[model samples]
Target: MKTIQYIAAVLCSLVLSGCSDFSDSINTDPTRPGVASGTQLIANAALYLPGLSSSPKGEFMAQYLAETQYVGTSLYPQESTSFYSWYEEPLMNLQAAIDSDDLDAGEGPIANQIAVARILKAYFFWNVTDRWGDIPYTEALQGSDNFTPVYDSQESIYNSLFEELKAAVATVVEGDIDNDIIYGGDMSKWQKLGNTVRLLMALRLSEVAPARGKEEFNDALNDGVFSSNEDNLVFRHLPEANNQNYWYGQIVNQNREWWALTETLVDEMKPVNDPRLPVYGNPARESDEYVGLEFGEEENIGTEEYSLLGSDIYAQDAPVYLVTYAQVRFAMAEAAERGWIGGDAATYYNQAVEASVEQWTGSTEEVADFLTQPGIAFEPGNAMKMIGTQRWVHLYMFGYEAWAEWRRTGYPDNLVEPNGVPVPGRLSYPDNEVFNNADNYEEAVQRQFGGDDDIHGKVWWDQ
Candidate 1:
């Protein structure tokens, strides 16, 4: 009894003595930072912005590339997709940056840091809502405070994104930011990018919300956006293995023959003698001629028989474009076609084509020749179709944006799936949401998609 009592007394004393030490050390991870600076957080958030833009699935879905092997994603399957990483990692870091007050000490000016975070947050959230409609927005990223955030309607989300972007543009102040991988802390470039994002978002609502789209589109243009390729928002990849381009990682480092140019894109480029063809793809090994595999073809096609992605794209340091002046020009052309902006639609169209070609080839001779072709030249009646098709072509490496535009415009309307299944309108909600956030997920589906988490269910703006 005495020995037991003695042991208990020693244990209690140790617990009492170690409690403060334990508390202090429990959250202290030597290798990990307890609190990253605002700049570091901004850098972290910027890193994730290019993920979907860099992914092959977006290209495959847009019919820019056909799968040579492992064709599961090419054929639409009812699969769960998640943007959880965006919310959990970089978005969290961005939130921390916005909420941090240490900017005056070393982390850039408080207003600038917060403004940058808001722009990035809007960018990430825009991607999320586009991929999966009715996402958790206004109440999202609240951490444990609101585990089951109510999903905000896509319309409401768009409204808030516009407001956030406007505020972010207005809030830019003089400050030096660290670890700014995108713009190197250039506030002007960041402002342009924010406004450009707004422009793209505004154009997305053209069909469904024409009046609102026109207002926002003009507002973004007046606010200032990308004017030239020099103003492109690109994430320049490093030569190191960890930070190399996605195509280089997949095609060179992994030694995978997983992707090939699609006939849909090559067919459009070939007859027109498009200069971008050579830049977009390599000649096939067998024929030494540019040939693309038809997307969703059931026949076993060898990678060598079809053209591979261009060597420039497979380079270790190829940059991923988030927004380009070509895209902005195309948007303007479309806006002009719809009478939302003042300008000749053909002029903007020609400029967009020239910009896209020059961006790839760094010369105008081929573009001039290509533009003079009968079918290639801009026509007033067919302006919308011309704009949509050319926009798809210009958005070659930017697969997600291309796919989104295709969904919106339906220009290349002849896309066919081998299985006879229709193209997916949106990606299904993540499996984690279905399993963990069951109630909220159900509510979102019920309210937005007629009680089904279906890929074919169109988003609000798609109408």
Candidate 2:
């Protein structure tokens, strides 16, 4: 807690020095050309996603870009700065500006900004909780009161996020949608997304907190959640060449470096004749033949020989999907399995699979033909497995979700730990978290079962 206070003090000191990171990223600078507000800050916070899949963030996501672990591993690291926004001190501090001493009830109020910030905060904290487990949430984003805040249980954190999401959604009543950056600021979409987020969170906890998770899932379902693609929660990527794809910034630019599709992901798609495969992986190094390089194969051997997932999707640039129609469908399928709601598990699962095929190439028959096969057809426990597997495949470039889904469902059973993984799970908190916030860092580390953010430790929720 003291660390959070000191950090706050330092940030406050920085504010007086003429430049403050806290207010700067959020457009809090008064001298800027155009007047900025909380809406822009929410937008900037979401911007963190693109940078994640493409640059240093991409390397972290790829966890394979490096020559050392070329193929696969525990997925996320346990010791690097998985945090894309700790550096955004200004945005984190913006909350304080609103709750300050000098405030007018109606002069450029905090409603829109606070709503967006809460939603954005949910997204940001989800990344942390999704990756690390039981992060310092009640304490986090507080700037001072919560700095170095103790970690909460994963279950508690999930609950809190849902509450925050609900309140954020409520702030934007049905009629107000213009300011929404995600859906033309659509309040309905925001509300739908809020409920949809609730559904996803419940699904994540289904196996862990079946009862409470089920109740929450029902509430979200009954409340009306996203049902169509038009309601999908995503940030459209600009044709901006620099931000096209994380890989475009990292691999496509120079020597053409990309991770060969792991055999685990490859094999799962092969049996079902999944269409997305060709779109996801590169061809075998030897020829344009469609063959996947096994996950743990000797570094990069037979891979250069085969063509991976259809080249069409990879060639154009796959947009970063924070959440999608396919994911919601799969979650619904999982909910059915638990008998939490109406709908056949196999039915929703099949829809999810076909959704993947269609999502990749825009063809429903293609999906039908693929699902007609035995390996891909709807079966008892297999539905979730198939849904999870394809979801993982679709998540090839989208880092955190792929890793998080794996933790929950353990599906697509083919994913293999790479040859020389340094650590399992995500990287540790940033160096600054350790050096300056030593006590908090130490306590958080102790809460982590592995003594450090090692793969063996089960995040409280996962445990």
Candidate 3:
């Protein structure tokens, strides 16, 4: 943490002074100009990756972690979540970098920097489109020139993303870049990350458009992807107040025990003797065993009685895994079962489980024993269920991604809260969109949901 912070500080100082001596750049600047240097723009854009992965709303939606106190989100409250901040900040910064010629050659090759920006931009857009279905894509981040940008279909957005990711991977040069908080400007890892994201996105179309899914999946597989846990794309938080883990702030700094593991997670893991259970959360205070509270339990809700997040998870400097080898392996396993790729589904399944266990537990000592359990064992007929369930568990605090997968696969078909509200298929468009971009918003809602804009409306891929 100290080394990373020191490097960042030095890089920021150098960039602010208009020097090309350092290899990295600043953490984040909300007031940063759209015309900033390529390095500065990329650095600022990268800052939001951690927050994206560890979103509390996503956690609640996935029912992995529940609110111990307020409990509103756990009950599946209907709300208009905004993507404006995403576009206004990171997405814009990434766009600036992608368009800029102000390259800091000292940081990395200009090609690599642009590639990184493009990849991050695609990822940010991916998150937005997944959450809200159709979104302002083609005209987004155009600044004041396009406040009322038309919403692009989710299908189009995904197609554009695949192209962007492919181009980004191909654009990489043989040079390590700095100012990259993720991967430390490791170009090979960046290439793999891009391909991995493409692979997963391709797989999302398995049900809706399997031909495209198979072609893209194999294209990504052939290009290259994460082969080991060391290649995981992670955002390492600092111990400083400005960059501490979000969970740490909620649980430790604020002295508020607001989030706890849900019964949905605890029941699945505990009964199967899942090795990741201990690493996922702590044992309940009252039970002295791992106990997850019922999702959306408004009455008799005590923070200590239910398992809170594991200590390491909420630690100030904990690293959030953005994309991982385990995720790619699971995608491979699923593709195999779908016959989109030629390989034994069980091989990839076992490897995915082993990779996930090694990733969370930091050892494979118990993986063999854990895999022998009935629920954990890989049976070809039951492959999809096993793969989907394990993928959900492996996703952990990556709530939105898990929620998206759940919607796609209908896996763990028991995501209902105590109030009888099942997980929402999608978040409604932001209120700002309804008011400010009413015409386009209405058109999108009408096109996608037959004029409803409701939470239960399916995204393009989910359909």
- The TM-score leader among the candidates is 3
Instruction: Give candidate 3's TM-score.
Output: 0.93
> Compared to the true structure, candidate 2 yields what TM-score?
0.81
Roughly what TM-score does model 1 have, to 2 decimal places? 0.92
For model 3, residues 1-463, the per-residue Cα lDDT tens digits are 4456435543443333322223444654545432356766677777778878777888987889878888875677777878887887788777877776667788789999999989989988998898999999998877768889999999999999999999999988889876677776689998998999999999899889999999999999999999999999888777777677888988898898888899889999999999888889999888889988888888878877889888889999888987899999899999988888999889998999999999888999998888889889998888899899999999999999999899999987777755777678899988888789999999999999999978888999998
What value of lDDT does candidate 2 attain over all alpha carbons? 0.58
Rank the candidate models, highest TM-score first: 3, 1, 2
Q: Candidate 2: where are CA atoms >4 Å away?
A: 1-31, 51-78, 82-113, 142-147, 174-181, 299-303, 308-317, 419-423
What tens-digit string does per-residue lDDT give for candidate 2 at 168-238? 77776434422234565556676787778778887777667789889888888888787766676664444
Off by over 4 Å in 1: 1-34, 104-107
Best by lDDT: 3
Candidate number that wins on lDDT, 1 or 2? 1
Which lDDT value does model 1 have at 181?
71
lDDT of each: 0.82, 0.58, 0.84
**Global Cα lDDT for candidate 3:** 0.84
Which digits, one per residue and each the tens of the lDDT, describe model 1 over residues 1-463?
3223223322332333111123355656565444455666676666666685888778876888888887776888888888788788767778877876565446567788889889998998898899898998888878778988889999999999999999999998887565577777788898999999999999999888999999999999999999999888887776765566878988888898788889888888888889889888999999999998988876868788999888887788887877899999999999998999999999999999999998888888877778989779999988899999999999997877887898999977767676788878998998888777889899999998899899999899997
